[model samples]
Target chain A: MNELVEFISNNLQLLYILILAIFIGVELIKNVPSVLHTPLMSGANALSGVVIVGALLVMLQAKPDDFLSLGLGFVAVILGILNVVGGFVVTDRMLQMFKKKK
Target chain B: MNITLSIIYLITTIAFVIGLKMLGHPQTAKKGNLISGVGMGLAIVATIFLHDFEVPSINYILIGIALLIGSVIGYFIAMKVAMTKMPELVSLFNGFGGGSALLIGLIEFGNFSEDATQTSTIIAAIIIGSITFTGSLIAWAKLNGSMKDIRLPKYNLINNLIILALIAFGAYIVMYDSTNLMLIYLLLFASLVYGVLFVIPIGGADMPVVISLLNSLTGIAAAITGILFGNMVMMVGGILVGSAGLILTFIMCNAMNRSLSNVIFGAFGGGDVAIAAVGKTGGTIKKTTASDSAIMLNYASKVVIVPGYGLAVAQAQHVIHELEELLTKKGVDVSYAIHPVAGRMPGHMNVLLAESNVAYDKLIEMDNINPQFPNTDVVLVVGANDVVNPAAHNDPSSPIYGMPILDVENAKHIIVNKRSMNAGYAGIENELFFNQKTSMLFGDAKSALTELVNELKNM
Candidate 1:
């Protein structure tokens, strides 16, 4: 319980940031025209791939002989990269199709 | 935790916000996507270079290899996928993101101990991420037509029980034994099973809601993982995505005039309702020919095309674009009446039409085009059914009752193109088909539109 309280106090700033970012996010996404829903979704989907950083940090901290730890981090990094790359590329492809009237 | 990396993350966060803001307009949306991509790129580069990790060198090699393999596969898949498969691809990507978060949680749990907050966040990440991952896989399978809808009897009750059990089981782990690998594995297994159960009952047409919901789940999972590490960029980015997805899910539900709970629990489009509608005839389906439809379209001063899932199935977007061009050249004011839930996904029809080079201005939203239906000359419903069904508005007994739909019946003439007299995704008889103003032009959308275009050109 003491450790939990200590962690909370230490990370209070991050918690505030998380809450504020959510409000701003909802406000920003509220007005996106329906025509762009798919692209917008795909774009945000890519952003979730930020987990790759955590994967990298974990991989770098794992012991040299700890194959299990290393393997988990490695696969996580791959999946994260796939999400980041595929999401942005697919969103860009979809957005490219929305051309103005000639 | 370093000062320089923190500044980079702050910059990346701002870029994401600005990019999302720019996405509200069509002309700037592509550039907005590019800006976000660049921000992601900067974050990746900064993480690789600036992060202080005191591990062996082989790990770096493995990371490099993984990055290369993932990027190559991702790029090819994105480049090669047809526009019609966008939803499935997005679902697949969402699953990948969730899978990564789940793995992160597992790895972190192994590395950290004796910290209640960290343990709780790790468990939350694992549960949410696993559910998002497996749920998205089911959604992808359903979208691609590889999986059939399976609704066990009393599924809502069953789903509720499973959720309760999971909560109890997770609470047990958190309170009593957070270190038990066996219990954690069991929790993961249960979460995955719940994920499959969550999506198996949902019909394919309701995929937009499911996909959006899962997208948000993945974001929330990522956010929890960020909380585990106290990473600002991950925290902010994931929250943004989480909220964005929530907003879209609500928009999709509102567009259908349904609530989120109703969409998830109603099981409205599972094809069971069709049996109830069987042998209950509404009205006779009046058949029309391509030549007749062409003549009607040619003479009309204003025309609106209503498209749906079948239009994409028949791959008729190109021919439809040609038809629109032919009509426009004949001095007709042509536009599209796009219902919010028109295709398999949100803005699906717009993407299809845009791929065939249909001008964005010509694709009118439902609210803006609904009032114009009364003044419109002809409404050519190509391979669409449910959105134009009058039962939604008038038949209180209908499952889709109260759902806002295109007022195609208000037009002076209605020409519907379909392959058969079958019901749409909701499995209900469309009373609009039998309206005196409506005529069914039966055929595949592509061939029928091609013939209609030929007929109009000869006229």
Candidate 2:
């Protein structure tokens, strides 16, 4: 059972490659109308915040022996969290400036 | 360690997707950010509980120190940095992200033996991460005016050769299984140098494209790091970065009427105008006094004010606002015409106008107000130069030819406020100044607006 778990974890490398290939493929065809670019860019920026969630998962799954991984993962999670929060706050502030005046 | 944490992670991912979607519209962008932030906070909290045993005292101390230093510096910089400098600041932040990823890759490589798979991942991360870090730093410097706008000498050939050599060295190290990490370090340094060289030649005007490019590099690096560690977040994050950056790069290229290949490889040699057009026309311009300009404004039934970087430079938004209020009270209809890429960054004019408490309703974008210029009685151009230049409309041989322009010249009377008849960012003479309908009001924008305001009081 322990060997099986280790094997599954080790195969994550393949998953990374697959995902990257898909991303690049999607990007190549992302010639959306120019009007939608701003909204799309903003949406993508917001999505990039997912780094925090991934960082957390890595931290949780890391072995106690791999203290450095655990530590760096935790730090990444924190910063990623701050980025998401701050990004939202700033985005909101900018939007509010454009709100239709009563 | 188990299902609860997984659920939280899943929820965070959903939030990320939603936030990104919300970011597409200006109206819901804030809420999207809020939701994303909530997800991030949850993720952080989930992380703290994941580790089982007690952390060493030193590790805990280090974490605390890092957090404190980071937050304080981050908060201070965000608060102090002007909105005009925000894009450059963002580029700097992206650099930090790339730096972090590169460090992770280096650390991982140090511990892991040179297996085929791990070596490939490490090599990819080293190249991408190092390039992202160095490219972003040069971008930051250029935007902040620390570096010259011109391209560094022999930059293109040197960069290509270095990148090719690094990749070759990387393949060699991977294939040989050499413990000599010196080659890896050399690759990292070459990548870093290549990044700096790539961005230094890109002029300030093309900053938007450079920024997007650096962002994509950061994403690619992060994804490669994920491959090294087999982490889903890094991969997803990198994809997001790379895709978004590519999209933005395309948009910026369209905005400037240049192709991606042209933007990257073509060294933009001239200012806002083509160098060939210089000295082609040397017609004398008509000048007017503050009193005469005041008379034109006072008698006009409809006035359109075009504000630009000069207004911001003179810190004259407030005075302009006051002038607008005076004009409106006198029953002269007034509206402001704003160009899409006016000022340094996108929406720069809107921000400056908003800062001075200009009524949101009166501020009209270029497309909406441009057609109204034909019937306009007076056009008050305040410190605006390039965006209003008539060369864009009439002169085909002009560099900015075919680019859309505000039809300020269509107005029956034109009062242009400027310090002198010097050319704009394009460094070419403005034919609009020499037009028979135009009158140059030579003075500082803030002072001229103030004088106009004072003159209106007596009328």
Candidate 3:
């Protein structure tokens, strides 16, 4: 817990990046036309699967005797994996359909 | 410590941003998606192999198994699902994303669910994550037509109370020891229930808003988890999800002419069954058959196909493509007139038609196609109603008024294919149905299309 606090205090730069990322996200998405909203939704859904990072970190730090933490880590890992893999594949499948008014 | 790893993470972030940027254009979207996928692949690889890059433990076998199994399942599902079921597929995937984040938050709070500083973000993750997970499931079911709209006694009161309770309890947990593991897990459970209740009252037409809202909720969950993990890439990805989902949600709301807060809190629009009895309804309906409709198409010089959720429901995109091809062969100017919110999700109709190998050149937007309808010899409206309704333009008291709709009414002749004359998702009367220029062909869309194809052959 102390390490968590120390890391947070030390990593104030990352926090600023997170906030900056939000503004960039708002601007980036405005360019997406409404017709592609489903794919955008799907793509964003897959994007959130980035939580696989936190799940991995939790598992790595778990004590050998700690079963509950380990179990949660396993659930997190499997679900996270499914999310990213499934989301990207499905979104690509949908995106393959878009064409112009030729 | 590992400068190389940081560089790779930066590359991954650039991949994501650039991928999304290119996704805005139809010409470059597929390549953009592949770029983003590469970024994700890069992130996963760097995480697994690098020691100082993350925490200590490494189990190649577990990671390998999970990836292999998940990939196979995802591939099969994505490949096998029919175009009509795309909304359901996307909803389930979004649910998994949110559910994973909520579980991560719970795991974080294992030692303490509410420790002043960590409590705020962790709880945020759980509440938003759980809501997204269940809310998406409900929305998916409703879109799939498997679930009916549910309204409990005092639905609004119960919903408001539950939200208030969740907030108050969360604050209380922060103030107390937050030691009880039961309470932590219970919060997830309570929130899930709230999610289900939250979506049950929204009418079918408003489902795009619900689904998009759920997508944004999952994004917020991911963003909070990113902050908790102190990972820059995850944070960037989460922010993207949050903003993209939110933008999509707002677009849906604006198109519907409904306020976002009204859709979320008011739980507006009800009436479980569509106004099913088409014959007794007010306007005089001129009924036609596949053969007669086909004759009309056979003679028409120009035609437009207006598709809606019903087209997706009946998996008729392929047949519509075939019809379009046939019409083009006879020198009919064939192009689709797509309303902004025609299908259950954004770009849903386009994706479906693409699966059928329909030319994108022939698919036209509402703004561009409306003016062409008056000049069009025939407008073949299949499985759509509210978007083509005349009421949107003229009926101020109507629920869906001011909603921009396709100008199918102006076409010289209108041919609508449906199973019956039931009201559309908005659960209001579409005066377009009663228009004297309109002729309703009551039957399953797929079969009607198929029969129409056969009739065209005879011609």
TM-score against truth, every candidate: 0.97, 0.82, 0.92
Error of 2 at B419 (Å): 3.8
Please list the residue runs of candidate 1 whose C-alpha ends up more than 4 Å from where it truly belongs after superposition.
A1-10
Query: Which structure among the candidates has the greatest TM-score?
Result: 1
RMSD (CA, angstroms), candidate 3: 3.4
- Per-candidate DockQ values are 0.80, 0.21, 0.53
Q: Model 2, range B242-323, lDDT digits (tens) per residue?
A: 7667766776676656788766776553543356777776787889988888888988999999998788778898999999
Candidate 2 to native Cα RMSD, angstroms: 5.2
lDDT string, candidate 1, B27-121, tens digits? 99889888888888888878877876675789888889989989999999999998889999999999999999999888887778466667788
DockQ-based CAPRI category assigned to the predicted complex of candidate 1:
medium
Error of 1 at B303 (Å): 1.1
User: Residue A21 deviation, candidate 2, in Å?
Assistant: 11
Off by over 4 Å in 2: A1-96, B51-57, B112-114, B177-179, B269-275, B359-361, B394-397
Q: List pairs with backbone clashes in candidate 1.
A: none
The candidates' interface RMSDs, in order, read 1.0, 5.0, 2.3
